[model samples]
Target: MPSVPLHSSATPIVSAVLAFDVGGTDTKAGLVLSAAPGEVPEIVDIQRFRTALDAQRPGPVLVDFLDGLLRRYATEHPQLRIAAVGVTVPGLVDEQRGIGIYAANLGWRDYPFRAELESRMQLPVSFGHDVGAAGDAEVALGAGQGAENAMILVVGTGIAAALYIDGRRLRAGGYAGEVGHAMAPAPDGGLQIMEATGSAGAIGRRYLLAHPDFSGGAREVLTLAKAGDTVAQRIWAEAIAALAFSIAQAVAMIGISKVVIGGGLAEAGDELFEPLAKQIDQLLSFQPRPVLVKAMLGQNAGLIGSALKAQELLSAASSEPSTGALP
Candidate 1:
């Protein structure tokens, strides 16, 4: 876990907020209370629940589960009032509209997520994409902090990126950072998406395709590569090359000063970063090379980001005049 930073001595403490990060397999909830006003909130009562298995009816089930979690939290902490609620979910999310456009893993489509949650909970709701929210947290408090421009890439089952430039997140209507789908040179002398060649899932599939007798995943393939397996080495090298190509392209296009990589594969540490940095260096001529760093927040980044969003909602509401009307 990354160390939480303290606020300046001048600010005072404020109210609490509720936050949830809904993932494909699990949902994490936290109550965030500020140690001081205008400071990073201290997260408390953090809990994780398994996501509903009924994909056919996940929306209602998820909403009910969230309601239950919130109720339990409120009951336990009667002294703390939740000003707003923030929820981050995986998939094609329209944060501005608070609609879950599509989530193949969670099996939902065009769900009015924010409205439903707010209607039931009677609180302001902040909804956003999981990766985007995580990136925001990274920029605000983790690896990408202090950089004027940066790209945070989460390489898990699939690959995606959160682009930050000029002190602002470039959402581009939620379609801007789909780096996995970007075109790259395929092994067969044709164009292919970066995820199809370099993602963890892709690496596993490639290994299986080359050696049908093997029954291991990407981790095993990587171990074999390190131990001098020719096929594993070739597959790993190709994936690295494709990823480097994509990073070089991003650097050329955005002039990002930093690239923070997270997720399971980043655990490889030097093995992944050293080669990737070298490849990117070789690929770029006059372009300034971006420094590559590992993610500092681990898996809790999305949850922290949700808390930040909740705080943002609180701030916005505080600035608005009370109409004696409910949203």
Candidate 2:
């Protein structure tokens, strides 16, 4: 979905479809439906649950969970005929092969996700990366709209980006957006991982490490920084700098026209973007400074992306009217 081209029209489908986005903390499910013919499906009835991944064998466990979910939905929404499924998960994925190559927290490697789901559920399954899916939604209907070249950064528990150049997403075999692991300047004059100094999770974690007595997360840390807490201020500033460095790196390589910031950190509003913009300016020389914008799709972008994939699959397989590909 990330680089599948920007589609703003309807997917040819006559039935309801299931879209699932599996996150580190929770798994989200939604039903997508088109109110009328020739319209994009509206994602509705969103639900979430604690993600339970078995370290030894996540494939079967996930399939079973999905099967149960399908049954529950069938019972709950009996009038609707469920046709296909589109699922997105985090980590390194092979979209073409429909394989989940690796996920450290999800504890899976080289798992045949699409095959297993289709074989078990007897429904067509469209699989992709979670962040990529989110990026797809952002581009299609969210803040990244109308941007020809951009980076959609999702800085949650971890950090990843969805790079769009010339209005096409750069998949790079699902390894394109692992910015959190990229090296950055550290306070100690040594290089540290970007997520260690940035990322919403890292911001709170580093603050807690510095002040064990603190009892809140990144929002609280930002508040403390505003109140002149030196430790909080330092942590916050370093996080911003790390993000700027990573964004600058992306700009240097591809000349992004806009940076759409999403995930938990983006909720900080001006607290994150204003300083991030300033730091990035200080780091750049002659590059076109990219406009920083917040993601408008909230946290359900992946669900929307997945649903779009499901509808697209249905359209491709059936005689439903669809806008095949639109730039």
Which candidate leads the pack in lDDT?
2
**Model 1 C-alpha lDDT versus the unseen true structure:** 0.85
For model 1, the stretches where C-alpha displacement exceeds 4 angstroms are 1-15, 35-41, 53-58, 76-80, 211-216, 321-327
Q: Alpha carbon lDDT of residue 321, candidate 2?
A: 67
Q: Top model by TM-score, which number?
A: 2
Pairs of residues at least 3 apart in sequence or in different chains that clash in candidate 2: none
Separately for all candidates shown, the number of backbone clashes (residues 3 or more apart, or on different chains) is 1, 0
Q: What's each prediction's TM-score?
A: 0.86, 0.90
lDDT of 1 at 296: 85
Residue runs of model 2 more than 4 Å from their true location after superposition: 1-14, 35-41, 319-327
TM-score of 1: 0.86
Q: 1-327, model 2: which lDDT tens digit per residue?
A: 466657646543346788899877789998887545333457667899787778888877887888788778767776667888889999998888999998888888899999999888888899999888888878887899889898999998889988899989888887888888999998678999999889889899999998888889899999999999999999999999999999999999888879999999999999998999999998888998999999988888888878777777777877656543311
| Candidate 1 residue-wise lDDT, 108-170, digit = tens | 888888999999999888999888988988888889888888999888888888888898878
